[model samples]
Target: MNINLLKLDFKNIRDFRELTIPLFKEKDVNTPFHISLIQMPNGTGKTTAINLLRSIVCGEILEKEIVLSYQPTRYKCDEGYFGVLLIIDRDLYSLGMHFDYRNGVMKYETSRPKEVGGGKSFSYDLPPYIRNVMTKNFTRLFVFDGEFSENILDNKKTEAETSIKFLYFLDRLELLKIKADTLLENKRKSTKDTKVHTQQGLTKLETEEKKLKQTLVDLNKQLKKFKEESVSTSQEIEDLEKKNDELLSENETIQAEFIEFTTKISSLENDIRNGTNIILNILRTPSQFSLKMNDKLKNLSENMSKLKLPRSVSSEFFKELSDEDECICGRPILNDSIKKKILEKAEQYLAADHITTTNCIKGSIRNMDDYKELSNLRDNLYSYINEKQQLIQAKDLLKLRLDEKDQEKAEKIKQEIIRLSSNLVDLNLYIQSLETKNSAFQEEFSLNEYENINLCQKKLIEKRKRLDEASDTVNFSNGVSLFKKMMDNIISSSIDKIKEDLISKSNTRISQLMGNKDVVLEKIEGCIYVDGKKGVSQGQSLAVAYAFLSTLFEDSPHKVPFIVDSPVGSLDLKVRREVSDLIPKLFAQLIVFIISSERNGFVEGIGKYEDVQFLTIYKDERETGSIAFHTDKKFFMQFHSENEEVQV
Candidate 1:
C-alpha cells in the first residue's frame, strides 16, 4: 500500500486552517527520483505537519491520545481533521481521523476499496491486517525529527531491537513458537492410560513455571521503563542546567551595561551642574554692567569731538592759518585786532604736551569691548548648559527605561535560572533514586526467576522418575518434550539468522553510502560493533542507522513512504552529501522535509533530477494560515545560491 494523498482540514484545528499535499503524481514516475522535497522555514507549521501525519498513523491503536497530544497554547475548541488516502492494489481507501475536543473522544474511520461500479462505504473499524501495518512502533522508523535522528546516532540497543522486530516480524515468529510449545504440552497432558497422577503433577508444575516466567517478563518490562524514564529525566536536568548557566551569563552582561549607563548619567549630571553655575553668574551681571560700559564709551566719544587743535590736530596747522592774510574760511584779516582774535581762539586749544598726555590717557582707559567678551561667554555658557541638559535628559531617560524594563526582565530571568537550577537538583535526585530502586528490583527478580525455574525442573525430573518406576514406558512425555525443544531451537536459530542477515545487509548499505569512511558494522551476539570495536563516531552511527533502515525497508513487503524531517542536519558537509546521495535510491517514494539552511548541501548532494517535486511551505501574508504547494525548482535554487534569508 502506497499513500498518495494527505488532506488536513483545520476548520477545527486552532491556528491552522487547512493543508493538503499530493505526494505522488501518476505521470512523473521515475526510478530513484520519486523525491518530494518540502522546504519549510522554522515555525511555518513544519512540526505541525509532521505531528499531523504521526497522529494519523498513531490513531490506528490509540483513541483520544492523538488529538490530546497536540494541545498547544493556540489550540481552542475547534474541529481538526486529517486523512490518509492510500492506493492498495489499485483500489482507493481513505483512512481519516476527526478530532473534536469539544465533543470529547476523537473519531477514527476508514473506507473500504470502492466497488467496481463506483460506491463507497465508510466504517469505524479498520481491517485487522491494515491496522497492524500502521502501528506506532514503526512510526518512528518512517516519520522522525532531529531528536530521533540523534537517537539513531546514539545507536541505542532498544532501538536496534525494535528495528529488528519490525524489520523481520520476529515477534510473530516468537508468538508462533509459544503456540507450538502450548500445543506440545497439551498433547503430553492427553496421555490417558499410564502415569495419570504423574501427568497431573507435571501439568501443575508447568503452570506454575509459566506464571513465574510471565512475572519475570513483567518485572523486566517495568525495570526497563524505569531506566528509560531515569535517562530522560537526567537529560532534562542537564538541559536545564545549561540553560540556567546561559541565563546567568546574560544577566551579568546586562548588569554590566546598566553600570556603564549609570556612570555616564552621573558624569552628565556633573557637567550640567557646573554649566548652570557659570551661566547663572553671567546672567547676573550682563544687563547692568554692559549698559554702563556702553554709556561711558559714548561720553568719551562726545568729549573727543569737542577737543580743538593741538590734541586733535598739530599746532603747526594753527600757526599757518594765523600767518595767512585772510581767515581760512575766506574772511579778510588785515588788522592786528582780527589776527589777534584768531590767535586767541587757537591759544585756548591745549598745548602739544597736554594733547599728547590726553591721548595717552584715553588709550589707557578700560575699553568697553570687554562687554563683547562677557556677552559671548554668557551665550556660550547658556548653549553649553542647554546641551548638557539634553545629554543628561537622554541619559536619564535611558536609565529610566533600563530600570523600568530591562532590570525587571533581567531579574525575572535570574529568578527563572534559580528555579531551573533547583528543579535540576530535584530531578537528578529523583533519577538517582529511581535507578537505585530499579537495580534492586532487577536483582531480586533475577534471583526469584532462577529459583522458580530450578524448582520447576526438579519437579519435572521427579515426575518423570516416578512415571518410569511405575510404568515401563515414558515415550509419550519424552516425545512431547523433544518436540517442544525442537521448536525452541528453531525459534532461537531463526532469530539468530535474522539478526545476522540484518547486520550483513546493513553493512552493505553502509558501504554503499559511506565506503570511503572505512568503517564496518557488525552485530556480535546482540551488541553492535564498529570495525570489530565497540564504539563508532556520531557520523558513523547515523550512517549505520540509515543503512539499517534502508536494508529493513528494502526487504519489507510493505512499501511505506519515508517521511524524514531534517535527516542530514547533524552531519558534516561530506557525510551529508553521502547520505543525501543515498536517500533517493533507497526509498520508492521519499518525502524529504528540510529547512532552507540545509538546502545548499542537500541540493549539491542530490545533484540533478528531472522528476523531483519541490514544495515550499510558508505563512500566508494576507491570512493567519500556512500554505504549501509545489513550486518552481529554480526559485529555491536562487534562494540558496544568493543566500537570501527565507521569509517564511
Candidate 2:
C-alpha cells in the first residue's frame, strides 16, 4: 500500500511557535504524484519532518520536552502536541499525540474516517500488519543515509542479509526458527541430564572412556616398540650367524694351511737328520782311518825292509814256500841247516817285494787330496743341516701359533655362538610371552571398547529419543514454533532459487543503469560478488544496492513508498542518473530527500516523468526556522491558544 503524506500540523514544534505543512493540495490528493523530490536545505526541519512522519505512520510516542523544544521557548512552561494526516490506500487516517511536559506523560491517538471506521473511531487502532510494516529495520529500507546504502551493498556485511530479511519480512520467520532451535537445545540438555542415565554415570563413563583410549594408545605404542625390537634382534642374529660362518671357513683354511706346513717341516727335519748323520759319520771315520792307515803303512815298510831279500815277493808267498819245504833249485837237502837257510832266503825275498809295493801305494794315496775334499764336504753338509733345522723350527712355530689361534679363537667364537643362540631362544620365548599378553590385552581392550561405545551410544540414543519427545512438547507449548522452523527450512531451501532470480534481476538493473555488464553481480554462499570479487567503488556499490532494493521491492508482496534521503548523493554523475531513472519505475511513489547539489542530476534524469513534485524547503534567513513550499497547500498552524493556516 502506498502511504501518501497529506498534511502535518503542530503546536510548539521545533523552531516554530506554530507550523502547518501540506504535502499535496486538495486537488492533487485525488491524483497523487508517483514521484516527489523534496528539496530541503541543511538542518531546516527536514530531519524533524521525517521523524514526525515516521511517528505518525508507526504510532511512535515522542517525548513532551522534545516536542516542546521544537518550537524553542514557545511551550517550555506548558503542554504541546503534533498531529499528522495520511492517506493510505485511498483511506484517510489521522494520528496525533499530546505531550504533558510538567507531568512527564504522553498520549497517542489514531482515527479513521467514520465512513471507513464502521461508524466508530478507535484511538491508536493501527492494524498489526500495518504497524509491523513501519519498523526501525524497515524504516532504514525507506529512510537511510549513504552509510546504510554502503552497508546494503557491502558483500562482507552481515547487515546485508539482515536488511534483505527485514525488507521481505523473513526476519520474523528466522526468529521463529531461532526460538525453536533454542527450545530444542534446552530440551536436549534436559533430556541428557535427566533421561536414560544419571549425570554422574555419564561423567564416569566418559572418564573411563578417556582412560581406556589413553591406555589403548599407550599399548599400541608399546606393541610397535616391541615389534621393532623383535625385528632388530632377528636381524642381529642373522648378521652374527653369517659372521660366524665366515670365521669358521677362515679357521678351516688356517688349520689346513697349518697341517700342510707341519708336513713340510717334518720332511725337512728328516732330511736334516739324515744329512747330518751321514756327514758326521763320514767325518769321524775318515779322520780316524787316515791316521790308522798311515801308521800301518810305516810299520809294514819297516818290517819289510828288515827282512826282504827280493823286491817282487810278498810275505804270504814266502810263508807258503817255507811251508812247502822246497826251493827253486829243486835240491832235496835232508839236513836241518840247509832247510832253515832255504826258508829264510824265501822269506827275505817276499818281505822285500812287500816293502817296495807298500811304499809306492802310500806315496799315491798321499798325492790324492782326499782329506781336504772330505773336510769341505762335511762342512757343507753341516751348513745344510743347520739351515734345514732352522726352517723346520720356523715351520713348527708357525704351526704351533696357528693351532693355538685356531683353538683359542674358534672355541671362543663357538661358545659365543652357542650363547647367542641360547639368548635368541630366550628372547623368542619372551617375545612370544609378550605377544600372548598383548593379544590378551588387545582382546580385552577390544571387548571393553566395544562395550563402552555400545553402552554410550545406546544411552545417547535413548536420551535423544526422550529429548525428541521433550522438544515436541516444547514446540506444542510454544504454539507451532517447530512448524515455523520447518517452514523456515522449506523456505531456506528455496532461497537459492529466489537468490538466483534476484541475481538475474539485479544484474539486469545494473546493466540497464550502467549501460554495460562489466560488473556482473552474483551471490555465492550468501555474499555478493562483483565480477566474482568484492568491494566495488561507492558509485558501483550504490548501484548494486539500488539493484538489490529494486529486486527486493519487485519480489515483495507489499507495496510501499520508497522514502530515501540523499539516495544517490554518494553516486557519481553517470550512476546518479541511472539510479534516478531506475528508482522511479521500482516504486509507485518515490519520495526523495535531496539537497540543491543533488537536485540537478535527479531532475535531468527523472523530471520528465509525470506526477513528479519538486518541493523545496524555504529556510528563513536567520536559519532558525523553515517551511515546505508547494503551489497547492493548506494546513493548520496553532498559536499559543489559537489555530491558523500557513501556506505558500
List residue ranges in candidate 2 displaced over 4 A. Answer: 61-77, 118-123, 177-495, 512-519, 524-528, 531-540, 621-648
| lDDT of prediction 1 | 0.60
| Deviating ranges (above 4 Å) for candidate 1 | 1-11, 26-33, 58-65, 69-77, 115-121, 124-129, 146-156, 176-491, 509-517, 524-528, 532-541, 626-630, 634-648
Tens-place lDDT per residue, model 2, 1-648, is 656666667665565545665556457654456777776665556677676666656666667555544544422545556787667777777777766656666677777766665332335666566787877677667655556666665566755566666776767776767777677566656655443233444455556556655554554555566667667766776776555445544555455655565566567577667766766666564434376665665565566567542355566665565555455568555567775766677654546556676667656544432332456556666776677677555543442344566556646655776776676676655444334534464455454332333333444555555545554544444555547757778666656667777889888878776677777676734446556244355556566766777677777766666667777764567767766766786667667776656654656777668777666655454544444354321210111111211110
- Encode model 1's per-residue lDDT on 52-119: one tens digit a residue: 77767656434466566544335344566667666654556666777666554567667775453333
TM-score (all chains, Cα) for each model: 0.48, 0.48
lDDT of 1 at 270: 77
Q: Give the TM-score comparing model 2 with the true structure, all chains together.
A: 0.48
Specify the poorest-scoring 10-residue window by lDDT in model 1. 639-648
Scored against the true structure, residue 51 in model 2 reaches a CA lDDT of 68
